[model samples]
Target chain A: MAIRSSLWLEYQIEANWTSPVIFILYNTLKPVGGSLLLLAMYYVVTGGFLGGEGLYFLYIGNAFYMLVAQTLFSVGWIIHDDREHYQTMKYLYISPLSYFTYLMGRSAMRFLLSLLPLSVLIGLGILLKIPYRIEILLLIGTFFLGWIFVISAGLLLSGVNMLTARHGNSIGQAFSGIFYLFSGVVFPIHVLPGWASTAALGLPSTYWFSLVRRSVLGKEVDSIMSGFTTGDVAVRLIIISVLFFVISYLTFRLADYLARKKGIIDMSTTY
Target chain B: MNVMLNLRALKGRAYPRMIGAVREPSWMFWDTFLPILSMAAYIYVYRSLDAPKEFEGFVVLGGVMTTYWMNVLWGMASQLYWEKETANLQLYLAAPMSKMSILAGMALGGMFSTSVRCISIILIGIVIFKVEFVVTSVGLLLGIFGVTLVALYGMGMVFASLFLMWGREAWHLNMIMEEPIYFLSGYSFPVKALGSLSAFATVIPFTLGLDAMRQLTFPSMAAQWGLVSPHLELGILLVMSITLLYVARLSLDRMERMGRSKGTLTMRWQ
Candidate 1:
C-alpha cells in the first residue's frame, strides 16, 4: 500500500508540471538525444554509420546503462527532493511507514520512467541493424538482478545525502559519471588503463552490463568479462548485488539513527 | 537608465556566485573531476580506435568548452528558476534594477568558476593524455572565445526569463537539454562529422566556437575536419552575439511582464 501510494505520488509530481504530450516528448527526446550523441561519436571515430560490431556494442551498452543512471540518480536524489523541494520529509518519517519501502517505491517509479527511453534506444538499435538474439528468461532475470543492485546503491546514497548538506546534490551524477567510465558503458573496459580496468572489476555494474549484453546479443559480443562464462558472470553479479543490498540496509539504519539523533531529518537547505 | 545603479546591481548579483565558486572547495573538486572522467573516457575511445593524435586534442578542447556550456545552462540559464524556488525571485522582481544587469552579472560570475575548471581540465588533459596543440594566432583564438561567451550567455539570459515564466517544467527542460546539446554541439568530436546537421547546430554558439578552436589548435586536421572556415565561424559568432543579447533583452522585458501579470513571479513548487 505504501509503495502504491508513493508511486502515485511520484507520478503526480513528475507529470503535473506539463501537458501529457509535452511530457512524453521531453522523456523521449532526452534519451534519444543521449544515444544519438554516442552514435555521433562512433560515427566520427570509426567512420562507419552503424554497421560495425563496435557500434552495436556501444549502442547496447549505453542503452542498458541508462537504467542505472536514471534509477540510481532518481532514488539517490529523493532525499533532497522531499526535504528541500517538497518540504515533506519530516511528515513522511513521522508516519507509521518504513522509509525503506517508500524509497523502493520511488525507485520503482524511476525504473518505470526509464523504460520509455530504454525501449526507444533499443528500437533505434534495431533500426541500425544491430543483431539482437534475446533469451527471454535470461534477460528478465538479469534485469531484476541489475535493478536490485541499482536500488540498493541508491538507498545507500540517499542515506548519505540525509547526513550531508545540500551542496552534495551532484553526488548522484558524479557517481553515475564514474560508472559510465569504469563499467564499459560506451567502450570496452579492457581498453581502460590497467589500474582503471582493475578498478572496474570491483564494481558490480561492470558485470551487470556484461550479463545484460549477453542476454540480448546472445553472446558476450564485447566485454572485459569475455573470458568468464554466463554462469560465472551471473554468480558474480548475484553475489555483489546481494552484498550491496545488505550494506545498504545497514547504512540506512545507521544514517537514520544519526539523523534522528542529530535532529536534522527535516533540515531544509533552501531558505 | 541610471547606469551606476544597474552596475551595482550587477555587482551585487555577481558577488555571491564568484564567492560561492571558491567558498565551497568541494564544488571545484567535482566540477573538474567529473569532466576529466568524461574527457578520459573519450580519449580512451579514440585511443582504442587508433584515431589520429589530433582527435584526442579535439576531445580536450571539447572538454574545456563543455565547462562553459554547463555553466551557462545551470549557472546562468536556470539560475533564475532556482532563485524563484528558493524565494529570492520575489526580492529580485521587487528591486528597481534591470533584469539584464542581474543576468550579465551571473554570466560574469559563472565565468570565473568555469574558467578555473576549464583550466584545470586542460592542464590535466596535457599531463594525463599527452595532448598537444598548435596555435598560429592567439589573438584569433581569444577573439572567437570572447564572442562565443557573449552569444552563449545572451542565449542563457533568454532562457533565464523563460525558465522563470514556467514552473517545474524548467527543471525538466534543463534536464532534457544537456545531452542533446552535447550531441548537437558535437562536444566531443568535430561538428562537421554530423554532416548537414552541423548547419542546424550553428544556432548553438558553442558548436562553431569549438569547431573554430579545433581548427586553429589542430591545423593539420582543419582541412579534413573543419566544418567551415574559422573566419566564417568568427563572423557568425559576432553577429550572434549582438542578435542574441538584443533578443535576451526583449525576452526578459516581455517575460517579466507576463510573470507579473500571471502572478507567477513568486509561485513555488508548481
Candidate 2:
C-alpha cells in the first residue's frame, strides 16, 4: 500500500512539476474550448440560438469525455513511457509490487487529477448560466462509476500497448477518438448508423454517458437504450465494468507472458 | 558553387523525409482514418442540430484542410524538437546547409505526405456523405489552394522558430493549440458565425483560406453569408504569406545567434 501510494505521489508530482502552467491551462481550456466550439456549431446550425438545455447537455458531455480521454491517454502512455522511454519495465517486472496495483494506483490518481478540470468546467457552466440542479450525490456516483469503466478500458488498452509497444500512444489516441465518436459523448448514439450504434452498445461508455446525462441534466437520456431506468442502466454498467475489468487483467497477463517469451518488453525502445 | 551545394542538400533532406513518412504504413493509416472519424463526428453534430445539408460539405472540406494544419504543426514546426530529442539537431546544425533549407525541405516533404492523406479524406467524405462541390473555375480554385498552402506553410516557419526556442515546452504548446485552432479556424462551421471571435480567426491564414475555398466552391452559400470575394482573400493570403515568411526568417536567424550565446540550442531541457 505504501509503495503504491508513493508511486502515485511520484507520478502526480512529476507530471505537474514538469510543466505546471501548461498542465493547468490545458486541462482547464481544452475541454472548455471544445465545448464552446461545439456550442458554436450548434448556434450556427440553429441560426444563433442554443437553449439552456442544449448548452448544459454539451457542457456535461464534453467534460466527461475529456475526463475519459485524459485517463485513457495517461494510462496507455504511462505504460509506454515506463517500458520504453525510461527503460524501467524490467525493473517494474521484477518489483515486489504487482503491475496491476501500480496501474490502479495511477488510475486513482488520474481520477483525482481529472477533478481539477471537472471543477473548472462546472464553474464555466455556472458562469454561462446553464441551468442545472446540482445533485452532488448523483454526480459523484456517476463520476466513480464512469472512472471504473474508463480505467478498465484503459487497462485493456495498456495490455494492447504491452503487446505493441511502438504503436501504443497512437493506438490509445485512435481508441479515444473512436469512443468519442461512438460513445455519445458529443452526440447521442441513436443518431449514429446502425452498425455504429450496435458497436456502441458493446462499450460501457454508452451506458455510462446515458446515466451521466440523466444525473447531471435531470433529464432522461434520449439514447438508443432510453427505455431503461437509471437503476437498470446502473446495473448494466456495473455488470459490464466487472466483466471488462476481469478481461483486462487476463489480457494484461497474457500479453506479459508473450512479451517475456519474445524478449521484446525491455528492448522495445529501439524503434 | 555554394548555391548548387545547398540545393543538393535540400533535395537530400527532402526526399528521405518524404519517403520515410510515406513508408510508415501505420502513420498513413491513422492520418487518413482519424480525420474521417472527426468529420463523421461533426456530421452527426450537424444532423442532431438539423443543420442544412450543405453544411456536411463544409465540415468535410474543413476536416480535409485540417490535415495541412496538422502537418504544419507536427511535421514541420515540431521537427526541430524531434531532432533535438534524438540528438540529431546538433549534427544538422553543424552540417554545411543553411537551417532554412532544412526547414523548407521538411515543409515541402510534409506537404507531399499530407496531400496524399488529404485527397483521400476528401474523396471519402464526398462519397460517403454525398457532398457536392460546384467549382466555378478549376484554375481559380487551384490558385487559391496554392496561395493558401504558401501562407499556411509560412505561418509554419514562424511556429518552427518559436517551437525550437521553447524546447520540451513545444509539446505542451502543440497540445494546447489543437482544439482552439479548430474552433478559431471554423473547422466545421462558417467563421462569420464566430462574430467577435472572427476578428481573431481572420489573423490565421487557415480561416482566410478555408473561407475563400468554400466561397469559391459554393458561390450560392457564399452569397448568403456576404463573404469577401475570392480575389481579395487571395490578395490577403499573399500579403500574410510574404510578411510571415520574412519575419520567420529574421526570427530564426536571431534565435540561432541567441541560442549560440546562451547554449540553449544544445540544452536538452529549457
Candidate 3:
C-alpha cells in the first residue's frame, strides 16, 4: 500500500517537472482558452453576451468537460506509455502491487491535479461576471461521482487499447472528440440531432453534465432524467459508476490474459 | 548527381509518409472522421446562441481549415521527434540528402492527406447542417487556401527544426499549440470581434487565409478584412512563406551543430 501510494506521488512529481512551463500553460490556458472560444462563438452568433445563465452553462460545461477529457486521455496514455514508450509494463505487470490499486491512485492524483485548472476557470468565470450558485456539498459530491464514472470509462478504454495495440492513441483521440461532441460539453444535448441525443442518453456524461450545470448554474436538470429529482440523478450516477467499474475491471483482466496468450505484453512498437 | 539524388530523396520520403498514413483504415478514420465531432460541437454552439444560420457555414469553414493546421503541427512539426523515437532520425541525418527535401516531402504528404479529410468534413457539414455558401469567386478562394498551406507548412518546417533539438519536450510544445491557435486564429468566430487581439491575429497565416476565404465566400456575413483585400493577404502569405522557409533552413543547420556538440540527437528520453 505504501509502495503504491509512493509510486503515485512520484508519477505526479515527474509529470509536473517534465516541461513544467508547458504543463502549467496547458492546464491553465487550455481550459481558459477553450471556455473563451465557446463564449466568443456564442457572442458572435447571438450578437450579445450569453447572459448569466448561458455564460454559467458554457463556463462550467467547458471546464468540467476539459477535466474529464484530460483524465480519460491520461489514463489510456499512461498504460500506452508504460508498454510502448518506457518499456516498464512487463515489470509492473509482474510486480506484487495491485494494478487496480495503482490505477486508482493515479486517477486520484489526476483528479486532484485537474482541480487547479478547474479553479482557474472558475476564477475567470467570476471575473467575467458570470452568475453562480455554488452548492459546495453537491458540487463536491458530483465531482466525486463524475470522476469515478470518467475513470472507469477510461480504464475500459485502456483495456481496449491493450487488445488493439496499434490504434491506442487513435482510440483515445476518437473518444475525446466523440465525447466532446455528444456529451453536451459546449451545448445542450437537445440541440444535437435526434440520433446523437439518443446516443448521449447512454453516456454517464449526460447525467454528470446535468448534475454539474444544475449545481453550479442553478439550471434546471433535464433530458432523459427530466422526471427524476436531484437525488434520483445522484442514485442513477452511483449505479452507472458501479456498472462501469465492474465492466472495466473485467475488460482489463481479459486484456491481460489475451496479451499473455499472444506474447505481446512487452511489445515496444505501436504496431 | 546531386540534383538527381535530391529528387529521388523527395519522392522516396514523400511516398512512404502518404502510404503510411493510409495503410491502416483506423488511422484514416481517426484523422478524418473523428474531427467532424469537433465541428459538430461548434455547430451546437451556434444553435445554442441562435446565431445567424450562416454562422454554421463559418464554423464549418473554420473546422475545415483547422485540418491543415493540424497537419502542420502534428504531421510535419512533430515528424522529426517521431523519427528520433523510432531510431530513423539517425539514419536520415547520416544520409546525403538535404534535410529540407525530407521535410518538404513530409509537408507535401501531410497536405495531401489532410486536404482529403478537410474536403470530407466540409461536405459532411454542408449535407448535415444545410450550410449554404455564397462563393463569389472560386479562384480567389482557392488561391487563399493554396497560399495559406504554403505559409503554414513553412512554419511547420521551422517547428520541425526546433523539435529536433527539443527531444521529448516536443510533445508538450505540440499540445500547447492546439487550443490556443484555435482561439487566436478565430477558427469558429470572427477575429474582428476579438477587439484588440484582432491586430495580433491578423499576423497569423491561417487567420489571414481564413478571413480572406470567408470574405470571398460569404461577403455579407464575413468580418472586415484586416488586410483590405484577398490579394494582399496572398502576398503577405507568400512573403511569410519564403522568410519562414529560410529560417527553417538556418535553424536546421544550427540545431544539427548543437545536437552534435551536446550528443543529444541520439539521446533518448532526454
Per-residue lDDT tens digits for candidate 1, residues A211-271, read 8888989988554689889999999889988988999889988998999999988776431
Tell how far residue A252 is off in model 2, in angstroms: 4.3
Error of 2 at B270 (Å): 5.2
Give the alpha carbon lDDT tens digit for every residue of A54-89 in model 2.
556666888878888767756766666677555677
Q: Compared with the true structure, what per-residue lDDT tens digits does model 3 show for residues A1-271? A: 8446845753564365466665766667766777778878877665666464555666778888877866765676667667776667788878887666777777667767778888888887777777788888999999989888877877777776675544324345456777788877777778888898888877777778888877887665344545567887787778877887899889988987887799887775422
lDDT of each: 0.82, 0.75, 0.76
What TM-score does chain A reach in every model? 0.94, 0.90, 0.88
Alpha carbon lDDT at B124, candidate 2: 78
* TM-score of candidate 1 to 2 decimals: 0.94
Consecutive 10-residue window with the lowest summed lDDT within model 3 chain B: B221-230
| lDDT tens digits by residue: candidate 3, B1-270 | 498888888888788656766565555665788778878888887787677777788788898888888878877888777777757778888999898888888888777778788889888877888888899899988888888888889899999989988866677667657777889998988777788887787666899898888888778765443335778878888898889889999998898888889887887655
lDDT of 2 by residue, B48-134 (tens): 777788788888889878878877887777767666654667887788878778778877877776788788878877787778899
> What is the alpha-carbon lDDT of model 1 when measured against the actual structure?
0.82
All models, DockQ values?
Answer: 0.49, 0.40, 0.49
Native contact share for candidate 3: 0.51
For every model shown, what is its TM-score relative to the native structure? Answer: 0.94, 0.89, 0.91
Return the TM-score for candidate 2, rounded to 2 decimals: 0.89
